[model samples]
Target: MQKDLIKELCLTQDLIDIAGTGTASQSSTSKWSKENDAQRAVSGKEFKDFAFHTDMETNPWWQVEFEMPVAVEYIIINNRKRSPFDERASELSIVAYDNEDNEKLLHSGTMYFGSEDRGCPLIIPLKGNVSLKKLRITLLKEDYLHLSNISFLISDPLRSFGDKPVFIANRGDGLGERLRALLNSMVLAKEFDGHFIFSWPLSFSKSEFHAIDNPENVFGRDFIDSYLVTRDVLNRCEIKDLRNTMDFISCDNDDYKKIGINLDQNSLKNQIKDKNLQPKNLISEYKLAFEKINFNEGVTEAINLAKSVQLKDKVLGIHLRTGDIVYSDYRYMDRYYNKVVPFYTVESLITRYLEMGYDIVLFSLDSSACRYFKDKYGVVISNDLIPEEYDDIQRAFFDIVLMSRCTEIVGGLSGFAILSSWIGGSKISTYKKILSEEEIKSSFTHSLSENGVLSSGFISPLLKSFSIAHYLQSFKDFSSIIERIELLKKCIEIDNGNNYYRLLLALDYYKEKNFSAADGILLEAVNSTDKSNIKWLAKTKFPKITILSIYTLELEKYASQGSIVAAYVAFLSRYYYDEIDMNIAFYKDFIQKQHNNKNSIDTEFLKEIQEKVNLKAENL
Candidate 1:
């Protein structure tokens, strides 16, 4: 008696045969044609009733196509329990093909056919959740292929993920350290397939900690609530259990073993000194999810300060980092950098920027450093001009905001320096060796050239204005949306066809639930052939089917043209029409472009991404 082989699993659960026409390397002369009928093997009935048989060959292969890309957890293969052919499925390889024609080797080597004495259903669990359009099984060393049944357990997103989520209890760390922790957690959440509770409380007292501003004080309360899932929310009845029961994890402990391919030994030593300071292993797919940190009142005030100070558009920003840093962390700095570079004094950096034709230089330093620069260069730091009660935390936030507005930034080795330069959106220059006038001259000579100049004023205004609009959209406050819309409209009137402004206007409409108005603007922005707009478009969830279809069509058109942003958008599209191939294409194109440009640091970053995707840099 052939006992019921399939047990434990809900054989009658929401089962569907999504397999399309199947093809094989070679067809069998038997009636079980290697065509669409191969899907019949998926039928949960007795294995003897149906099987996908193929003719004898060196390496025979059989493939099943799914109607759409489905998130698969595991696949169960039923082998014939009969005599000789029982072990036919022993050495086989399974490959999954996404819609973009990218192939992933899901399973290989020996089969999971439970032992000879007491065989169970051959279940092959996927390592991670993946979306696939087709699956192929090939005989590696075997001469024949016989597949009884191939069934997959599609993923249910609503179901809790098996592994517990992580949360961190951040101590009184510097703002940069805190931010790095947040960034690290984002990486963990993506890799581990779990949520993260941002547990850093806004209000805490630490005499040792120089800066400790509530997140709401820097980024608006409304903005933080919308984008970031706060720790306060985690304490709620519905979520508290999940937080308490789930594992408590911290990114500080993550060794970042995967981040060594791109950096040299010296650079690696500096980065790894503090785990929190390690350069983020950025995953493009997770970019939208990491958009939690945005601008707030602090940022707004920074912009107003920039304007009020009348710091010329082409100002240079310098973080000499010689205030509390020189005395408190001198040993720490010496360890990483090998020696003290004396040329990074306040007067020297200010003079350097001035020599490069910068009208002013924004200084994010202690008042002592500020006074030193003023005494020598007769230049008052921007912070000195702004009248306010400035605590260390508040001052640090102000400095960060101000630095982010700079056209170009040069700094010493510090995580805060790195953050300011990055958020400022410019080519960052750092000094590792002894900073001589010659070295400074060699670096700034290009800046002194016209080609090195960036539109100093535009980045800040664009980012700040968009931040406000994004905040309003997140809250879905109709009245605020109206005000935002008016502001964006005014910007558009001044600078027509600015995609960022247009996207903000569109989002304002989307927040107001005016899909029609939003669609009109989105359609215009999408048609412009600018890839930047695609990220914004991807963030939006259209309420109307017609608008969604239109947007998808426009996105496809751009994606086909090899726009990485469009391809990314298609990958993130809510309609689930995108495949892994789009991501592959986007990365290939992006790597090729970045590789051509000889920016060593940026190229290293690209190489890190290449390593993440298992793609060899030389191959491209």
Candidate 2:
């Protein structure tokens, strides 16, 4: 398991063709068209003799055809090594086409050069088992996409748990929250005949993170083949239940029942009420569930490392989450509103722990915050103990597990710290309000035990409103205004507390020239005749003009605090208001400032708006 345990090879030793925009000449007399070139590429050899080369083009392609439909788990591409001038396949995309000419994009990314001259292979793990008759590699950027080797791993459909309900556990949240979610989900999933596939930090996984080149390592070859990443076993396989991070976090049995699974929470609740079920403490209950599940090598290693680092009942843990929150705009509220926790005033808190006979203070913190804590208190930062070569996810996983080893914990507002405190079963003191265990219980759609034991939980009123509002607001396109209004009206019937939802409904009405209805709702939501509200009164072909304007004004006080959608809306609002001079000035400013900073703005919408405003402004 330590070595790169490549699954069984299923690639045929056939001569593939190079034919595309710039591939005609590449097929003649070149290293690409060399006899046995394609065969050598997939023959598990990374030597220059086994490489295939193509000419540079805007869009060059190399394709290989399998004799029959083969289930592809994943593909690895090793670039040719020509040393100094070796321009590796920098940015490329992989596409799979079936016999019927149906195609799907499998993976896309830059082929990063690993350590030394040996370099690293670019691994493209597909989402699930994809049966493709032909596979093609296309260069996204202008370059020759060279290949030293093309290795294919076939999927084993007969793998165990194939019959069980499958859930893809992809947590895009902070590491600690993700682990907490996984623990909760595994508990609920066990209520039904459920299995899970953990795909975290998916496309960004690197060989350096795995280190040692041993497959048995947490991120090693065997670990990846078994769990994580998207592979053929992931493709074409039937998923009885599929939930994203949010869906999994807030899912109930009703959600499952909607997907035709008859797992009912009400039955379980009735059984519990009738004393037909033995009640268990929620924490220990989930602990038992977590015990039943098997974590991948990565998680197991993290837990082991945590155990090794734990002091004998004298460790004090403190988590300072300062990276993203410091830069986060608090004025504009995002979907989930976890209260921000401050760490600057915690010196006294740590001093008390030190005086109370704690031998070690294990500080889990980001790079920016680590220095401050280390210098001020002379404590050990978790990052120093972890290998720097580990990727962000690996580092995050390790940090959380390490924090969980403490006897007592003082945490920030971060779910990372909160979840760690919970896992460690420590006396937790958090700076901000955390999600209550009652809320967690209510968030459950339904729960049932393996032996048909069931417990039903109520959905929070606010959660229900948010869920309906999210679906209704998703139809932001003008073309869907009519359908959107209908849906919003229905949502309002169920939950009318969301003023934002009402504003959306009003915008739809204004778009349809229902001035009376639009004005009524707008005034009710804001109760003002301010200049900002005038845009809502104005007629425009696109409702987004009014909709975006409304959000910008409503969240104007929270202007510094905004989501990507808010920024996008704010950009559109400027254009709709005919602020051409301001638009041009801001665009120039954006270009200048973004030279050093990441452009997190809505560039696509900006471009479209710029083109339209440029035309209109010229006439003015």
Candidate 3:
């Protein structure tokens, strides 16, 4: 009778005196004699019992309506017999009908049989709001010919209390892999109650951003809550020439007087005559406490691994990171693999070194790619010896470890790759098509001059260059793109058909508007035997239509400067005409609508050029 009580009812016991008419042989009339029938009274105090004379044709299902308003969060149905029906109960449906004659199907699922006739409970969240007075259950199938006891236990909703925080440990560069290991161990240690810390300089911001999206958006959100960062140890950073990028300020001078963070200790005491320290001082103390925690043992292992793998001269360590940060953008992909180095770039580089009679030990973060190379090219990969547990961390860690072990490293442009190059003291080589500082600063000016016709090829290469520059700035005295170019040249000498690298060189020439040089490199790349998809794009493919459009616009600027010859003007006009004609035809139906038009001026210019060519041809 209690609001949250487990009640059981037996239909046969409840309807003892009331008997249905049936044949003596078919019915259990004698089984319920007068005295026995009297004992089987259907009363509120007694459990209901039911006896069947014959199995019904329609599948037998019992439906119960809640007597009082109840908020049911879980439901359990116990089939009493060892075998309840001919087949197992396949489906269960819970439907609720409102007073207005509208029905809402609340929950539906398959029920699995468990021990103790305790048909596995189906946990449904009857979210805090809503009260239900009626409930119906439909059973699809059962194992036995008969049904037994059906009970309902109802109670209030359960709530979880506490702030779930995600811990992010800042271990600086070279500590990425170790930090990940530490966070992983801590998560396991904390019984996975909260999200573990993540090391920064992560593989990609897009990946990290996706990893920490809204609680309901990510798969692992239930385990993590908030982010954590370590204290800025000025002394350790001073040794490494590393500076903290995050600002940590103390409001009161006296707050960090012991740490020498504030110069005027007395100024804060006199400025705020409160009974206690100011909120700033309190916050500062909290920050200090948060940072001073001991390093996790897992992190210590990562540190040890970094120290153990020293850069010995003979070991040509190559750290290849294959995953892309901006995978969704076709332009970004083109910039990286086409304009930058593709997978074949590394493959060809290693092969070239192998041919040069130098023992090569290559390692990569992308194990799948590494395996493919080993099988296809017969190159010796070093990661085969790594422990399985060590391999369990994310691909970023795998790259860091490989880079730490290498003497000289080469790869596509990546922050993690750059960090590896810095920490390992390894000479680094990357795709040569990077933008200059002047080009980056004048990007806005160029964009305005081009009238919004921006080149993906130009933009992508510049963006990647800036990213690499920013990452390289962290390491002092070792920043030189020329050094990378030298390394790439050596690689080319060893490998005759390094088309990816050749393509990058061509892209660099293209960026400089050295069309002759670009065409020469691209022609060689197209003829090379390196039969990869990336190579194919760099060789035969013209600049992306968007890039061509921008290139023509830049030529128009040159023409406007009175520096363009007749040949130059004709080339620019032809390029613009070709791209505009293709784009216009592609979007002809859409562009017919006034609102769908894109760059009307460029369209009109292309039409004018076409008309002139037609008129000139008629006169000829």
Candidate 4:
């Protein structure tokens, strides 16, 4: 029943690029002002972004000094785009030091120019854990050293993550749901200056994505550990098992609820109110993301495919989602769309664009779409209608990235459609299939009976779950707990296969000290349930409930077959409450006889429990 962790965490939570906050100075500003010119490197300007120039001196350098010692994780040097000079930042040595004499060389490399152009940021990631008071970027060779728009990212200690606002992405669903969850969480985490954890969704969920039919282990550990992150980055933050200790349940979304948790500020017993947190907007964070967020081979191939097409700057990108998403005259709203929407005959819009002498690229998830546009207007159908060679996962990624290549993007009321708009710096818009007033009056509501339209309610699934959670949390008394228990029971009746809601009900019972009720849930969980859910119950709820009465005969069977915790708990229950007057020795002997007497953490823990039972007997 052991589960592998799918850990993909971002480092920029509550951390900022403190480079612009420091005072800038250079060796010599012959071409520009000494004090003012070096400031432009950190000024975050694009048009006339210029670095300080020094008089032809040995090892020309530009340095920034901070008031306090801080950890600088990333240094982005926007090198000049002008030819030959762009590669002049060849021999460079970036160092960090303080007035007390502690100094370390961060990065020493030939800051080479790669494929990315214009806003071509030469990123130097300092992978050391050392902190410094001053950061110095020096050119090793005897020449004028100039770099445009240099930005420094400060990633201070990530010690206090408990009780903070977090967008936990652990939903094991389709790629569309995963992407939408990540996108929404990214936006929310940015707005609240919080964090997002990519957990079991990638690995443990259904593999309807790349390789279908498998549900347990979709993403491999090696796949996750690939270009996504390195061991060095992984070592920085500790993974807190929220199941053991969840101090911060600040969110009220379905993302939290499906995992069996609801936010209750007043109801929480020991919610830490950390003062170190201050809400700050995610500026320059996107630039740092460009430095990080490395893609796998498939994504690289997709990007290359997009580049080959050369959908130039002014080209329009559109996501006309079909398949399960049908856009008839009567139907407009998408199932995953969070807002009220209109259905459009997209051909009319394409015709209008073609008439205006604008080239268009059409992208759709459905096969039947874009025939008229491809034939008449001769607009490029992206990926030749999502290249059949690539698998489901790659196709989705390719389509989104291809659309993102466009300067202006319009996704007409689809989650799959809207995703492309988020990849670039500026967020474009989801293309609405707006109908005229006369057309709207003439349109019938017959599409509401369709499967796709039925699924696309007024709100999103995440929000819908949140609405239920909020309803449960609003009760201010003991009735609140009772109401949650009853509500969850009813929800279980409705969604019987949803072990999460069942677990939530059981946990509510446990919280109320209703051991019998909790035992009831675990008894149900132990049989005819999913293996993961059973394993979860065996680990988290099983041991705790075993003390009540051994609960069921199933426990005895489990105890007989190498269940050390079960055997020990069965012994304790018999010794204290279940069996007639028997000494600790008798029950201990029973446990020793039933279980495979192995040396484990549970075995050691049981030894300590035996000692406690003997002491209680001696006291009696």
Candidates in order, TM-scores: namely 0.33, 0.41, 0.29, 0.34
Give one digit per residue, the lDDT tens place, for model 1 in 498-609: 5655755765565566656765675566566643344444443333322233445454454444333333334445324333343555555665665574655445545654
In model 4, the number of clashes is 3
Best by TM-score: 2
Q: Mind giving the per-residue lDDT tens digits that candidate 3 earns over 1-620? A: 21122322112111111111101111122332333332121111222223221233233333343322334444433332344441344465666544333567876676554322234423344542344445554554432222232333222111011233222333332333333333332432243243333323322333421222221221132232222211221111111100110121223322111121111111223323443423344323322322233433443454456556534455555554433322223222233342233332344455556665544555543455455556655655656645556522332344465564566665555545444554454666753323234433334233324322122222233233323322232222342455434433443454444454554454445455666665556556545565532323322333344322323444434333322121133233343444334333323322233233355543453354455445444554
Residue 482 in candidate 3, Cα distance off native in Å: 29
| Candidate models: Cα lDDT each | 0.48, 0.48, 0.36, 0.49
For candidate 4, lDDT tens digit of each residue in 1-620?
A: 00000011123343334556677888887754545787876664553434566777889998887644555566666665566776767788988896465778878877675212363465666643666678788888888777766666644233234444454444444454455444444443564555554432234224332222221222333434321221122233343333332333333333332221211111011222432322233323423332244445665575567556665556766665443322221111112332222223344545556666667887754333345456656888775845577865566667766676676666644544444554553345543333443333223122123422212343233322322332333222424687678656755664454454554565567567665676567546544355424434233332234223324344444444544444444454454443423545644565566356566655674675567566666766
Clashes of each: 0, 24, 22, 3
Candidate 3 lDDT for residue 372? 50
lDDT of prediction 1: 0.48
- Candidate 4 local accuracy as lDDT? 0.49
Candidate ranking (TM-score, best to worst): 2, 4, 1, 3
Our model 2 lands, by Cα RMSD against the true structure, at: 19.3
Error of 3 at 493 (Å): 29
